[model samples]
Target: MSEFRLDERLERDSDFLTKIGLCELRLMKDGRWPWLVLVPQRPDVSEVFDLTPLDQTMLTFETVLVTEALKTVTGATKINTGALGNIVRQLHVHVVARSEGDANWPGPVWGHGTAEPRSTEDTKALAARILDALKP
Candidate 1:
């Protein structure tokens, strides 16, 4: 089997945070929201069903883990998760924290506005908080 590699677009648009059982967790660079991306480590897979049964189970568990961690860290009113691979064909899941009056409140976060890139210091700080929340 080919070794796993992150898609170039994902690599460019996000910062690596940490890894879980079956995925590499990344923080999206857009500072508009507390967004996280979970990419399964399996190479060349582009859909959830493409993953093995074991991996599918692990993905579900990890997705929930990430969603809760995001909510804990951000205290968001609601959390959103999606796996629309229309643009990035990689099998990645998004776990986003949302509030009542965020920049694009009640609307989708994608394609609504320009991304405000997070500074390195800010990114590291957020990632550390998220990692801390993910601990058992």
Candidate 2:
């Protein structure tokens, strides 16, 4: 196995917030809605079941747990989850909370508009809140 989680490696390699959770819980980027990326930190794997049986099971369990937790946190009208890796082939699943009139209403969030970057303090506080919620 790799020394570090693939998601950890990606987070370290990027400037994004190193929020919380390793596999199960979501590390959301603080925003109007709860948008999460569930990434199993296994290396060189494309498919979900590419993981060992144990890891695959863990991933499934984690996905469900995060989905429910996100619902509780966001209270969204709908929850959308998908794995689209056209840009990053790192096997990450996205969980987005949906409402009736979101910015990308009736459309995909990607390529719809420029991302609204959160303020530093706001981002930090949001991350802290999510971390606290995900904590055991």
Candidate 3:
């Protein structure tokens, strides 16, 4: 198999955070919500079923870990997880920390409002917090 390459769209939309198990962790550039994405480092795989059974299991574990970490870091009231590949065909899972009255609230975060890009410093700080949360 070829070396894994992150989709260009994902690369453009998020900042590299850290790697967790079999996935490449990413922080969505949108500041409106504490969102994290997990992209399995597998070439040409565009769906969860595209992964091997072992990889699928590992991805599930990593997704849960990230969901918990995001909730803890953001003190979110609710957590959202999905793998909607409509826009970005690359296989990735989104673990978003949601609050009661956040911009969209009770609704989906996508197509709701403009994404407020995080400043470099802010993004770094958030990434650090996420990394800390992921620590054992």
Candidate 4:
């Protein structure tokens, strides 16, 4: 299959997502749940299994690294990771930290509410903390 690339739609939406660490971390557009999205630098891969075995392994490691980082920084009650391309088909994983009082608590975070959008400064601070907590 061809390499994965963000489509025009995703690319356009990414502008706002980028201001926050979400873009740097290849995270998704959701603003709640202290979530993250990790996409391998390689571009037409759609699913994790589509990656070469080595890349697949690296993605798994990245997922764990991100999970640990979020847990430490956000003190999330649970770390939820998955890859659902119903929207963006790039081979990327979502790492969302769940808490009882979170915005989307007790339900999926996809469309329950409008994204409040993190502030540039706050996002940077959060990103820095996440980076500092990262092991790899």
Give the Cα-based TM-score of candidate 3 against the true structure: 0.95
Off by over 4 Å in 4: 1-24, 27-31
For model 2, the stretches where C-alpha displacement exceeds 4 angstroms are 1-32
lDDT tens string, model 4, 1-136?
5544556655544322231222235444446657677767666677777678887777776677778988999988888777778877766667788998888676776657676676677677777777778744
TM-score per candidate, chains pooled: 0.96, 0.74, 0.95, 0.79
Q: Write the per-residue lDDT of candidate 3 for residues 35-60, one digit (tens) a residue.
A: 99999999988889999999999999
Q: Which stretches of candidate 1 lie over 4 Å from their true place?
A: none
- Model 1: per-residue Cα lDDT over 18-135, one tens digit each: 8898999999999999999999999889989999999999999999999999999999999989999999998999999999999989998977888898888999899999999999
Question: How far does residue 6 in candidate 1 sit from its true spot (Å)?
Answer: 0.4
Report lDDT (CA) for all predictions.
0.93, 0.64, 0.92, 0.67
Summing lDDT over every window of 10 consecutive residues in candidate 3, give the lowest-scoring window. Answer: 109-118
Number of clashes in model 4?
6
Clashes of each: 0, 0, 0, 6
Candidate 1 local accuracy as lDDT? 0.93
Candidate 2, residue 118: lDDT: 60
- On TM-score, the stronger of 1 and 2 is 1
* Segments of candidate 3 deviating more than 4 angstroms: none
